[model samples]
Target chain A: MRLLFTVILAASLSLSGCAGTQQKTLYDKLGGEAGVDKIVTHLVQNIGRDQQVFHYFAEANVKRFKKHLAWHLCDISDGPCDYTGDSMKQIHDGMQINERDFNHLVDLLIDAMYKADVSHRVQNQLLARLVPLRQDIIYR
Target chain B: MWKKLCILLPLLAPLSIEAADGKLIATPGVSQIEGAAGGGLVPWAQLAGYASRDEIAVNAFASRGSVDDYSLDVFGAQLNLYDRLELSIAEQEFKVDALNLNIRQRVLGSKLRLYGDIVYSRWPQLSVGLQYKQLDDALVANLLGAEDDSGTDYYIAASKLHLGAIGGLNWLWNVTGRYTEANQIGLLGFGADGEGYEWMLEASTAVLFGRHLAVGVEYRQKPDNLGPKEQDWKSAFVAWMPNKYVNLTAGYIDLGEIAGSDDQDGLYFSIMGTF
Candidate 1:
């Protein structure tokens, strides 16, 4: 058992070591503006196909959403882009988003990141930043 | 065994519906011994299965453990409704090898999520739960000088998952406060000569390696309400979730003393199927 724990600990350390010195920002790791654009496109496509949360986006403008989402991602990842979109609270004020729908959207976002070839570490970094915004977006 | 299979079949029949997979993979946690969604021994704040607020989920599990002088088999089922409330029922059969006898107990549990989400909400998830347990036969408990054949355990638990908080891996932790007087988790029954309810603390912490595997440790404080010293319990466990539909868990437990048997260490294994 001791050996097993040691191996697990070592494996986790090595895997986390992939972050490797933090010389690059999460935006760079996500391939900069081009990568954010791809991820947003994929997320929009996922929402388009999803039955659980598609209704929330049914009346939304696809092009504006794609642009704002990309900008949001870029800004949150410490990129050089200014987020010209509305505040999370302002945008989702009356949507009456429940926890389930909010989480579904997060799952879609993860899928989008994975499809954009983001590493797990980068994904987690981005997610950590986004987590605090859940309050502003959900149940409002 | 055939009867067990018969019960498991209908639970498996709903697998084709393709609903209740709304929650993230492995977020709901495995089944606890008392049929709650938690670690091997401690119940967590999360509910059972991956069902979200818009869906319903059902789960069934069986677990077995053997110590120096005793063995236990437990089978249970859980229903998670709308991600708000959970109901569970479990039956435990304990084999006392030294005395060549068996002790049976039934537990009915309910939990309600009071606030927050484990991963998303700024605050930790909080839940309140109750477990009503009854020993099928109170003969052994009476011999052990227990006060009652049935008891109830009430607890409030808080849990949270930190994204990449530990070495770029997810880390989850839970703390619970329980009010109970059950001796040996009610196997030897409830209370003692003049004892009543007492507050006990339980805690569990785990590190998730990706979305599939988790390694954790749990500590549960016990009440020595009977003749024998009811020592505390602790375990180190590993849980593997291949997908949303199945989970497997194995652990090494140190149940310090049980009905005067000291250092009752053992291995435990469990499997659960979700729908």
Candidate 2:
């Protein structure tokens, strides 16, 4: 009986120990750039069709937005891409964007993330990085 | 047999004690940021994107003064995952009474945080993501115009925990941005035809009174999106945590004013649980 108990304890400790060492990289978990590209593409498409906010991009270049978005996501996730677009504050400086407009964009992005099958953990990880921009995005 | 049972009881007692204390062990894979109740300076949940232990936390709150009227509520949840990365879903309902308008808004949202600890020997914690806010459109529409704003919002947040053991003060500063374009539903009304992008800046600080309690305050400034007019507000609150999974908070909030409307002040309460 004592031997059996000791064996169970040893096994449980070993199993828990193994669980602690599994390291996951964001790039690998997100399936690399291809996965990132899909998410960005879906997000851009949704933004393009949003009648309420689409006008902001009506005169702008869609291709540029797409490229910048991809780069931004890559750089954000600690990927190899470099973001050369305007600083968030500089780009949106004069636009009087509000909470509602901001939230709308968030919804579209969330939908895109869901459709792309981004894991919840990855999504939250990504969000923590983005939450700070509220200062630069909302002009007031 | 009786003597054998007695001998076993001592060993079994330790096992039972551990079983009860097991409840105290933080659930695997989830992380909880140490702070008082209320969303982060950036309007995201306070756990820094991690869920509560056992995928659950319960919070209760009350407040008076500063923002005007008082309010209270409870929040509970289990953090699905809380380790190097975190994902959690929480539900919060606010009973707000001020400006002659008494109403409640039930908000449901999910959050994800990537990377485990923002603070390291060399780097700060950073994350980016979006939140979908589906306001009871019909309910809000009847009460506050055609609720065209029940949509998702995006944000990118960067946080750094300041080393303050020397001063016994804990502080973190975060900046967030939301991309906004005209014609979409917003917190106010439909985006104006010529509306532009909006931004928000938030700063927060906390003072630990003991191992289990802390008081925190935050300030946020945002654009009104009504052309050149800028709107902003400040909030101050206290947070208490009995363990790793639950947090309770209460505070005063001022929502500024609109179209000559008096500034809206009110109390805020929040509860958070992690799995």
Candidate 3:
């Protein structure tokens, strides 16, 4: 009985140490910029075809928008992307936008990300980073 | 005295039992998203994040107010994940009478609370989300041949509960920031002439006055999309919840615009049901 108890204690200790070592940081799980770039590309492509929102971007340079969007996502996620686009406030000034419009845009982006097979955890992380912009985007 | 002790004993005993059991027995507040034991009529600036004590909920809404004269319909779904995060998707259909346009759009987003309680508990909650929108090309082409309406928006929000010293009334306050890049409507034309990005800031608060009743107010400031300008709005509302499955909300909204042509006020109503 004494020998058995000693063996059990040693096994539990080893298991706990292994568990600690297996923990992974969010940055590692996200696959870094490469993963974010793929997700951004998917999102831009999806938006470009969406008629409901496309009217707003009819004149937008898609290539430029894509590059800026990718960099913005990286910067927001605490990664390394420098964004040179206009400030959000400077860009959206004018046409009377509302909460309904904003919500519609959110739905499409989520669908695009889903189609890209972005992991739910990474999606949640990205969403959390984006929530603060409600004030800046929903004018009326 | 014996009768009084009997009455008191029953109440006091339960309190002690609850304490021993480690079950919080305070009056329940609204659940994070799906109408728990609290009120539902008030609008929370913070997305539900992922507090899923309840199950999934789906809601459909339609409204016509004094300001726009257009009929709007909204459909939405909310899900709680891992009892800590809330994900929601919503779509809006706008029928513009003046513009002779019918536009439909969809937004899919998720919110996760980094910390805090959505209901009954007293921790601060933080959330983030992203949205994409697309316009129907036929509608855009019909309304404005050269115009497109598609883009992405992102947001982050934080909320805290304040239990006032007077009568311990429950109060919730939240702040959110949003970044948007999309096209706006032109007065004389459509398309690239009215496109830009915007940064918005908003704040809201609600106070609980009775069981399943709350009143609140919200304010938001955003950029003008037509020209070099900006605009703001304010709203006041009341919420009522009779149970944990249904919610009713009504409010008044006001918007400020340039040249006074877009200034308007209207009433809004919404119903939410959770399974």
Candidate 4:
């Protein structure tokens, strides 16, 4: 009984240590809505510079797209925001998006994150959240 | 060596970093010891190639490592499909001038990436690889007490990239478990009179410097099937990429006493390119 009790105490202590002294949400680390807005704004700008992907956004409503993207990022980061934009499939369907375009967008997004001074941890976290959605965004 | 260098230089000339979107970048982790994908000396969980999830790519490499009494030269080619599977072949010659021993080996390898992405996924990427190693000299195998001149090595590896793990830099960690009897990676043949296949471990960790450079160390456990005291191997290496097409790597290696010789410390140089 005493050994089991000691093991439980050790496990709890390790778990607490892994939880960190202070847990900051990824949303907070990314600096909230204002930060998300800055990243999305720069992301769209970089996308415009990429010739391979630029054509897809050539006729897009920049202001609305930026707003929806910011909210979507916020939603993914566990922030207090709702991504009420069109479904990813609905927006990307019939775009004939290829692997090159998807990777190029990721590169652009990374550039935008850098421009906004987003931490590397936050950048990877965001990329991980978005990478799985490739199934819906590409090859359709 | 010069002839191979001439062939590689021309292929690397036309590729600028930004021009190759559909190509594989010269990431150091893609170069393995047996001329497969992984670290300089140990195979990582990632498959070899610059191919993305939907592309096909081919890569080839030539490398030289020299010690006081020996020099090893390797030339190899690999094909990566959709960044998921890899097939490779290598021919290696170990020339021990002092002992008047020239050993040659032919290695055929294949790797399958089971799941996860090294960079994009939250979980570590895992792969299983098989290598069929055949030695050309039967006299050396018999004299050295080797049970066979040909054997297969099977390994499972897991690699993870931890972004911002070290002072805002990316860190890569890999662990591999191998079942093999090949002595000194089959340069000395397989098995012994007293022993059969043995299990070993290879672990590697690297910290990325920017996007084009990685500095790391690797530790490889070797089976003690040889008569002499052949200890584990360790090395510190740096891999640099000037562009998407070219990769250069150098390492200071300590391969513990082999064939009754004292600790063999050496320098390793490798140049590789993908098309």
Candidate 5:
């Protein structure tokens, strides 16, 4: 148990040290526009291949989704971009996306971030910005 | 019991391996001592495995807790159906060194999700569960003036997970209200000669670091119905999930007093496998 304690202590210390180096904005840390675009592309590709959530995207316009989602990510991450797309509730109002699919999308996003070589710290920052939008997008 | 688990686990594994692994890793909590998906000692609202609504899940766990005057070992299995209902069975062995007695008990448990989701829903997830316990040997309980050798515990639990809520890490919490008549979680028996049931509140809080590790604390209120002054159970735990299939937990436990023994505190360890 003491070993476990030390491990957690060490991990937390390293994480805090990482935090101490957070002078860069989340957008800058996400590799700015290019990295965000890469992550969004991977997320869309993952969703296209996802068996559980693909049906929800089947009737949708892939090009439009990719653009708007990228814009949304950038807008939320304090990037110098503004999303002119519809509100989250407006776009997902009748989709009736449940918790399962929502979380599946989040999982895909995490994978996307990983593929883009985003650090866990930066990934969490992006997720923190996106999670609040869940209320507007689920079970509408 | 270990031999039995060795056989039963392999048999159970194949069935769940074919089931859909819909939920994400580390979302489903570890099995509690009573076989419910939860923290070390308190049952949370989450089910036992990573099954989503369209899948079924099976899990097995073993736990041991040793204190100043006694030790407890538990072996349990759980079946989760469609991410909504949970069924579980657990066997407990309580060894009292002071009395040189080995007491055994069996627990059968079921839980049904009542509302929401732990992560994505607007509100926290909620569930109701029941644990029916029977003492294998009634000698110690009867001698302690317990009313019955068997009893049932009913509880309602609410659980929530907040993404990046604390220091950019996930935070989880569970609150449970249980109405039970058992003493020493049914090893010492149920109720008193005149008493019936009491409501006990239990709580657990945890923070997820990265995706694999969780650190938490739990408190479980106890009912005192016998000569021994029963105290609440408290613990600080760390759970590591290397993947969806396995979780290992270690903790320091404070069990207070038991059967006239005071300051009963020690260590706990558990391992759970989900298929």
Candidate 6:
């Protein structure tokens, strides 16, 4: 059993090693504050037009929504900013956010990133880091 | 027949990754033999696709593997509905170019996600799977003293992902138990040397890297139902899902020996599209 564990450990190292050392925070890859703002702007622009998802944004304050989201992304990506907003559960509690809505938002976000020309690898990295947050934000 | 399927497969697949592309990328591994989402050579309990309970997705894949003198090709398609049930059909061809002999088989499979979401639930995803395998080479089966050329394998699998479990790394572990009498995965025959039913254990473990890539190893225990000695199967693989519609896997597999053949080890490659 110990031998087997060792073998797996070695295999994992071999695969992970090639990731190449770039200690830059996801914040930098996301192009810092300027880059994040552009993505948030595009995202909000789409929310009002998306038929299946626009209804949920009916009462939303587009300005505040964009700001909060930008700060949230910046903070989570290890950017040089802080998100002092309420927890995901508190913010989405009464909203009755369903999976479809959540996925819609995800789509908008990806589009926003693409508009900003964020590299695919960086996009994937950011998304990966944010995915775990779904448990906290969905159907709470 | 293969030519017609080649054209029909794409029309039935690819949902197109519209956004975050969350559900499709690397989360659900590639479809394995007998049709379950998993590593290259072994099936994990993961359902195929990024679709949640409210959605549906379909995919098809082709794999070609060469080990020493033998060439194995497999193709299949699957439908994942509501992230709960998976229905699939696959065909396999084992060719010995040197011997000018080819054996074919068909696999029909189904898996029910009994409980726990692989990604969301705190508990591991557990599923029950059944695969019905039918071989075309009845002559070889009969000569091998096989009781049947077809058999059904029943298995239950449990899988868990320990997110950020080690060194800010994620790892997945899976365990499966199967009851079968198919030797050489039904290529040589079924129910001969050690007939009836035999229980086998399969295990898989992988490390998730770069969010969209995974490296893993699988160990699948096999039943020595037909003589000459049946060794277990093992493979180490790297799987990548670059986007929602494309997934590629490359690996090295040691399929052990088959019917007096030497230990078969070689490169394995598979490409799949999810819709």
In candidate 3, position B187 carries an lDDT of 23
Q: Report the C-alpha displacement of residue B114, candidate 1, in angstroms.
A: 1.5
Q: Model 3 segments beyond 4 Å from truth?
A: A1-140, B1-68, B118-123, B138-148, B165-167, B183-195, B227-230, B258-260
User: lDDT of each structure?
Assistant: 0.87, 0.46, 0.50, 0.78, 0.87, 0.78
By DockQ, is 2 or 5 better? 5
Highest DockQ: give the candidate number. Answer: 1
Evaluation by DockQ, superior candidate among 1 and 6:
1
Tens-digit lDDT string for candidate 3 (B8-69): 34443333321211111111223221111212322233333212333222222223323454
Q: Which candidate should be chosen as best, given TM-score against the real structure?
A: 1
- Model 3 docking category: incorrect
By DockQ, the better pick of 2 and 6 is 6
- Over the stretch B1-275, how does candidate 5's per-residue lDDT look in tens digits? 67877988878767864754667678788989888999989999998898777678888999999998899999999989989999999999999997898999999999999997787667899999999999999999999889999999999999998876655677789999999999989999999988889999999888787889989888899998898799999989989999878899999999988988999999999999888
Cα-based TM-score, every candidate:
0.91, 0.45, 0.49, 0.82, 0.87, 0.79
- Over 4 Å off in model 6, which ranges? A1-8, A11-55, A66-90, A93-96, A103-140, B13-24, B97-99, B164-170
* Residue B194 displacement (Å), model 1: 3.0
lDDT of 6 by residue, B1-275 (tens): 45755797656634453322335347688878666777766677888877676777787888888898788888898888877898888898888776788989999998899997665576889998988999987877787678888998888999987654533457788998888888777877778844788888999988777567888888999987765778998888888877777788988888888667878889999888787
Error of 1 at A48 (Å): 3.3
Interface RMSD score of each model = 2.9, 17.9, 19.7, 9.5, 3.8, 5.8
**Fnat for each predicted structure, in order:** 0.42, 0.00, 0.00, 0.17, 0.29, 0.05
* Candidate 6 per-residue C-alpha lDDT over A1-140 given as tens digits, one digit per residue, 9 for 90 to 100: 33555877976565456444668788888899999998888888888778767887899888888889899999999988888898887887877776756865877887788899886557766766777777777776
Docking class of 6: incorrect
lDDT of 2 by residue, B179-255 (tens): 43211123343344444556555555444443345555566666454533435656666666676444566666665
Chain A: TM-score in each model: 0.89, 0.78, 0.72, 0.83, 0.87, 0.82
Q: In candidate 2, how many Å is residue A132 off?
A: 25
